[model samples]
Target: MFLRLSPRHGSRLLTRIYSAVAARRCPSCSAPLPTALPTCPSCSHIEPLPSTLSYHDIFGLPSVPNPFCVNTQTLKARFLQAQKICHPDAWSGKGKKEHDIAAAQSALLNKAYQTLLSPLQRANYILAQQGLSESETDRLGDTELIMEVMEAREELEEATSGEAVELARQRNRDRINRTQKILEKLIGERRWDDAKKAAVELKYWETIENAVKDLE
Candidate 1:
């Protein structure tokens, strides 16, 4: 069964887990590290992996919906806190070990922000997390729906001749809304099988959106 986590609780758990893993000693020499350091400066020994990291820790979030459901204000505060602690500038004039750790952590945090902020990417990330990737069977089943989107896309693609361009653009926008509604319904119903089908059709709608932009 898939376990669900509230964004607030999940973020706190991830932060605590990462902070604990970040607090460690050099494995080889048994020397303690500074509280701020994620790795030992002297031995260059790596620590065990943390249980959780940011959403971008692995390209995006797992199958959890509401990827941006985390309290925006709280997330902003936590991001600033992370920057203060893990920003590479803090390690200036420090040894390579500290610098590298700071840089790596900073990069991960930035990635998390980017992935969580984007809706489409977040959806793809969630699906991947569920071990439910885009598949051929999903595509085939949704072909009729996809064909509708594909036809619209082709119309937009071929609209360069006249005022048809404007008509195509408006149609594309309308489809975008309709496609979103379908996907939302499928996900809300936890119909993964159908969700995948909707996802495939949405991809075609997205393609039409992109293609129509060229007409403008």
Candidate 2:
């Protein structure tokens, strides 16, 4: 278990789960790294960023008990701040190596921000961390769920008017919102199986939502 809380008592007890995470440091200045972000806040050194860092870790967000609940304001603020330091524009006229590293960092940071900002992407990311591949997320086996998505698609295709499209669009939006809530709870409880299924459900809903946009 990554983390388990005590039920009978308020106190917590951790079992034998040894983790030895190395301290991140700036090579040039040897300053303690505050976040897993690509650049050092103290010395403006661009360290090699680890791909293993969770999206939460990149932004310095809490990654325990309830990583699904994100404060968007906090995430946005941090993302913009990080981008200012590492954006390729800021690195121009510097050495090619510095510019290249900054460009890479900027790209990775942008991808991380978009993934966490979207509900479906965030849920799928958690499942990926728990041993599911990005491709496997769409291979849903729930017959009922498949049928529901098919029917929704058919209804949208059959929509002949803007009003009809809006109606179908609203229906899909509602479904997506509901699935987001389910994902939040299942992920918080570490119910990986249920969470994976819900992530797939959300994926279908998101596809429909996009299709709705095309219709409009």
Candidate 3:
């Protein structure tokens, strides 16, 4: 008989394997890390760790968010491991300075995790990391895309019946999905201007989605 694993079980197994593989060692004694434990298991040296690493460095991921590939299982595994190491509560027994550092590192890790988890946020983060801002994003000059957004908003506003509203919502969902694909391609190609435009379009669609949800 063959054993079968469900998707959830498979993801959990992958996460554990990835976490174990990506675990960081103590700088002092080089003991294998189980989580982001504050002290070296072998040397018992209490030192601030993981605070010095960047978000991508902490996760063992590439510096840039890869548009073509994202392993959420790996990301989650890394996040959990980092949290274990950096959560302020984990450092409470140490010193005030160490506790404060842990708190700050935890905050940064949370921000990075949330940003990378959502496609829209991930795109915006990538653009922002490349020095693109909302004001800069508006200058993409895609008149047709702008017009389509305006038309969609108009249609949503004019929609009255339940069926009409549902139809409008579905249309907006389709537009959102299409724009997301464009955004991914633009980001993958390092086209900042076009990606920013796509990101802005996504924001509009998200607003429309919220409004439709409110109506329902």
Judging by lDDT against the true structure, name the best candidate: 2
Q: Candidate 2 at 114: error in angstroms?
A: 1.5
lDDT of 1 at 93: 62
- Number of colliding residue pairs in model 2: 0
Clashing pairs in 1: none
* TM-score list, all predictions: 0.59, 0.79, 0.71
Candidate 1's clash total is: 0
82-105, model 3: which lDDT tens digit per residue?
687677897788778877877776
Q: Which order, best to worst by TM-score? A: 2, 3, 1
Pairs clashing within candidate 2: none
lDDT of 1 by residue, 15-69 (tens): 6555554354545776765532344556654333343544633222233454423
TM-score of the candidate numbered 2? 0.79
lDDT of each: 0.59, 0.77, 0.70
Candidate 2 stretches greater than 4 Å from native: 1-43
